[model samples]
Target chain A: MEFIQQVINGLAQGGIYSLIAIGWTTVYGVVGVMNWTHGEVYMLGAFCGFFLFTRLHLPFLAGLLISMVAGSLIAMAIDQFGYKPLRKIGMPRMAGFITALGLSTLLRYSSTALFTPDPQAYPANLLSYKLLTLFHINGKAITVSSLHLMIFLGTLVIMAALELFIRKTLTGKAMLAASQDMSTLELMGANPEKLIKITFAISGALGAAAGVFVGTIYAINTMMGSLAGLKGWSVAILGGVGNMTGSMLGGLLLGIAESLTAGFVSTGYKDAIGFIIMILVLLVKPTGLKGYSAEEKV
Target chain B: MLEVNDLHVYYGNIHALKGLSLHVAEGEIVSLIGANGAGKTTLLTAIMNQVPRAQGSVSFLGRPTAGMTTPMIVRSGMTMVPEGRRIFPRCSVLDNLLLGAYARKDKKSVRRDLEDIFTSYPRLAERRRQIAGTLSGGEQQMLSISRALMSRPRLMLLDEPSMGLSPIIVEQVFATIKTINEGGTTVLLVEQNANQALRVSHRGYVMETGEVVLEDSSANLMQNAQVKEAYLGS
Candidate 1:
């Protein structure tokens, strides 16, 4: 029963990490930019959700939608007005990296300055306290919280939708084309710049949703994004950078490992679990679990 | 129809193309055969608007195309299958073909074109769901050609289609190019494989150091002494 409960908790937590991992991988895949500000985007998403809920007096679902859209727009603006011009100049790749790091710092400090440092909590009693028992044995029962259930189902739906979007849609095909070869993508009559803007938008939206979920589970804090962002990067590397499905699997696996480690092992080592998993994956398979070997362009 | 006049292109301090000019009439298979470093690829890139040109006038379908975006150039009924097999490797063969119609908005026409491309390249139909990157070199080249055909272009620019493919594949690829041209799509081909290119082309130009050194029918260039020695290895 305790094991079942732990598994449920792990699944819920994995849902949040998977969203962030998706955000990281999407931008990396399309733009070839390691957007460090992605974490700040997630943090800002939670802030957006909080602001809407308290200031606008909107419902939780409405707040979530607003956060997703707003976060996506903000990230697109950054990519277009901020990063695209730099790219036009044929700027060095290192410059883009530095620019991303700078943008991350700028977003973090700006968000902190705008929002209060004190933690903000979502309204209480809005989410139900109902629990459903999945199995019972030896007079002990295994139960799942409605919140956890929502998290699990919502993550699966979103992930499935994203997979379908990338695989089936015209715009998604363009994105995949751009990711593989931007120059060739242009040859196919696609505007690679537009694809990149869309990538950032999608990545930001996913991060924002993760932020909202975190705020719902825990509380919104200004600094929560940095730590979460680092964990998300770890998840990306673990699953293989630029591989979408790999990131999701990596995030879930990391989540379960962390939860189980904290539960049965040492709670103090929970923070170190992500990096440890990354190192292990790197040592075993450098291309990640599903990453293909990069071929040289002729 | 495509007309390039006095085109000048530069990469930083290096002058890649210097006062190059050529013309390809409707339904004509024109070949630009040149030695390495002769700016063949640059000419194609400049015409496709992929590379920035310092000074040039490209008239496509009898209209000036200066300062146009790549997609805009493509939308004007011209598309390029870039140098090397630059197929989107991670995507499936079907996705690659579908993306070639990226600029087209007519869904019914797009579907028809897709069906036509699959018919032309039946191997693609068999492996439509397979990732392009996993495909063999010959198959990737075929995908590249099939993908370009999906765009439904009036003019197709093929840059070195025979590059890096087996001799057997090259023969098949040239045969396919002939078939594509026979099907009414004008082709402007650039290649270092001068023999194969000239054999398939109607008219040919010999480019050297970004300048057109000679222009004639494919047979005349094949018999030209300089071309025979420098490019055809005869």
Candidate 2:
């Protein structure tokens, strides 16, 4: 019963990790940029949700949608102002990496100045904190909170929709092709720059959704993005850099590992669990669970 | 019809194409034959606006292509099958073909053209659901050509289509090039296989050190002593 309870407790957090990991991986796969600002996007998203829910009193779903849209806009703006000009000048890859690191630092500190370093909590009544029982093992009820159920279901729905979009839509297939060979995609008469923009937008939206979810479950602060962003990167690496499915599974696995560690081992080591697993995976598989060897592009 | 006049392309300090001039008349197979690094690939990429042109103009079907992006150039009815058969190896064969028609708004005709491609190359139809990377070298070359055709190009640029294929497959590829030209698509072929290229082409340009050293009817070029000594390996 305790093991089942720990698994249930881990799932919602796992789903959030999956969202963050997916956003990070998508941007890396298509745009070929390590967007360090993704966590900042998530932080902004939580703030977006905070403002909408606390000030405007918007419904939960509406807040999530608005946050996602705002996140995408923020991500697109970053690409436009930060990365696009560098690409146009044919800047070296290191230039882009440094630019990303600089942008991330700039966003983090600015937001810290703007929102202050203090942590703010969402309203306690944001969602009914009811624990619903599933079944009993030896008379101890296995219960899950309504918020956890919502987050888990929401993540599943988003992932499924994403899978269908990637498989069935032309734009999605073009994205896959762009990841493989951007120049050749241009030969097919698809603007790779436009695809890059779309990729950033999608990644930002996913990050923001994750931000909003985290804000609901825990306190939100301007400094939250730093650690969350690092965790997201760890998840991306753990999932196998550019592979989407790998990121998803990696997120879930990390979430569960963290939860179990916190439950049985030690809460002090919960955060370290993800990084340790990442190192182990790198030492062993190196490609994560679902990652395949990338074919050489000529 | 396509035209490039006084074209120059530079890779940083290396002048890849130096004031070269060429044209492909409508319904003609024009071959540009040269050794490696003689700017064949550079010239093709320059024509498509993928690489910057330091000097010169490229006009296709009577309009200047300067300032247009590569996709825009492709949308204007010119496409290149780049060197080494750069197919999206992870995508299914059917998905690869559909991506070829990405710029077209005529969905019905795109489907018809896809069917036409499948009929002409039944091997592609048989393996439409398979990942493209798993295809044999000859089939990949065929898919590459078919992918270029999907854009419904008025002028198609082919770079080294026979680079790593078997001799029999090379003959079949040349035969397909002939059939494609007969069906009314203008072709600009870049190849190291000078003998077969000249045989299949209506006109041939021999490039040396980023300049067109000779241009003439393929029959006359085939008979030229210098061409025989340098390129044809006779």
User: Largest TM-score belongs to which candidate?
Assistant: 2
The per-model DockQ list reads 0.86, 0.91
Cα distance off (Å), candidate 1, residue B227? 1.8
Q: Which stretches in model 1 have alpha-carbon errors above 4 Å?
A: A1-4, A137-139, A295-298
- Specify the poorest-scoring 10-residue window by lDDT in model 1 chain A: A289-298
- Of the true interface contacts, what fraction does each candidate have? 0.94, 0.92
Instruction: Supply every candidate's count of residue pairs whose N, Cα or C atoms clash at under 3 angstroms.
Output: 0, 0
Model 1 Cα lDDT, one tens digit per residue, B1-234: 799999999998989999999999999999998888999999998998888888879999899888789988888889988888888888899898899888888989989988887887888889999999899998999899888888888999999999998899999999999999999999999998999999999999999998999999999999999899999998
Q: Give the candidate number with the greatest DockQ.
A: 2
- The TM-score of chain B in candidate 1 is 0.98
Please, what are the lDDT tens digits per residue for candidate 2 over residues B55-152? 99989999999999999999999999899999999899999999999999999999999999999999999999999999999999999999999999
